[model samples]
Target: MDLNHSINFSSSSSTSSPFDDFIPLDSFMLPDCDPHLSTKEEEDDEAKRSSFTQLQKENIDLFWNQQLFEIQNTPVRKTHHEFPIARVKRIMKSDGKVKLISSETPILFSKACELFIMELTLRSWLHTEESKRRTLQHCDIYRAIRNDQLLDFLVSIANLF
Candidate 1:
């Protein structure tokens, strides 16, 4: 595990990352960005970033639009969930408070978990765009979970990422 092979840090007194790999330290400046200048596009982006609710609403609208397209084009689709019912049942049964669950209950839970994963991935992608990165990072997902109060339940899990 050679440090030079993975990450290369500059020796300059002023912390300026050349973007060899990774976000490198705390610097959030996008590539080729001039700190002193605020262009029209940058100002427009700043305005968009200021309102989280509007962004969330837009995302939800896009999701529903896609869903409607799917519904219209494919009238008959099988009920499918990415989550395995067996795994969901095992998790549901893990809690001592739960004694027994009906057959349909596990299926519903599996579908719910699948929907949650899709929504979380969508939200995380938004964060990735905010960082101006083509690739998704753990921090992006962490920021997504942190920003949404409804996702507070996953805060502990996100911290590990």
Candidate 2:
């Protein structure tokens, strides 16, 4: 019934607190203490960034050229209507506001999907050739997106960038 009697404050005694060893704010060195140091650091960073960007651009150009050469040398293959119609129908149904889908919609969607896959594969193959690798990687896709500014915008709008 007595609330004050149930609490005990002075049960243990430890003099040194955990934060006692911390250095004062005034004694800590500021990141930009020297103006010249910051300027030099910034210059170095800019140079590194520009060099990296140039390197990336060169790589992208090389890949693109290789893709062009391959395209010229390779024989054309016949297109097969392999896209799944059921999957396209399911996608069309995902929109709650649209209840009905035209019968031709699925065919168009399938063709679009095929084109999208082909484009992605071509871009990814370019990356593979750039890296001199046999298999494609996620980094290849990321680099491809980065190198293609238009694709970058599309990806950004799609929230994938």
Candidate 3:
């Protein structure tokens, strides 16, 4: 009933104190500082990244190698057939006899053969099953020449020069 009686500040044997502030048993000190990420988690993450990069490099290399292999293994058609006309004319100056004089632009027999083969293959592909026989045009032959088209054009220039 008394104000002084209710506000009891002195701790006696009978009354328990409820104000208990938390205090850590050990003093708070930062754990040893690692200059680099030295934890197991960091190491695992770095290892995973390295492995992923290595795998990606290997896959890229394999893909490129396979592409190169396919390119190298592709079959190139040869020219030697009769369907498309392939000719190499060479004119050598002569006094009805032996001495070799100035000669015209000499087309190699091997190159002529290659041209024939490519031309024939293209003509064959273009020909239908019913009508196979047809006179292959020189223009068509030139058009069908795939790889050496530029070379042939250059040679024509060289002959002019």
| Candidate with better lDDT, 1 vs 2 | 1
Q: Which residue segments of model 1 deviate by more than 4 Å?
A: 1-48, 51-53, 64-80
lDDT of 1 at 38: 64
Stretches of candidate 2 exceeding 4 Å from the true structure: 1-80, 153-161
The lDDT, on a scale of 0 to 1, for candidate 1 is 0.77
Residue-by-residue lDDT tens digits, candidate 1, 14-91:
875546455545565546667776698788777877775577769967986886686578644236657777888999
N/CA/C clash count, model 3: 3
lDDT of 2 by residue, 32-79 (tens): 466656878988989976876676567657756875786579664334
Candidate 3 local lDDT, 1-161, one digit each (tens): 34355555665767654333435555356567576776887889888757755654565466557656854795533443333322332223233563543222222344345555654454333432113446655443433333244346534544443
- Candidate 3 has which clashing residue pairs, if any? 79-113, 79-117, 80-117
How displaced is residue 108 in candidate 3, in Å? Answer: 28
Ranking of predictions according to TM-score: 1, 2, 3
On lDDT, who's better, 1 or 3? 1
Q: Clashes in model 1: which pairs? A: none
lDDT (C-alpha, whole model) for all candidates: 0.77, 0.68, 0.46
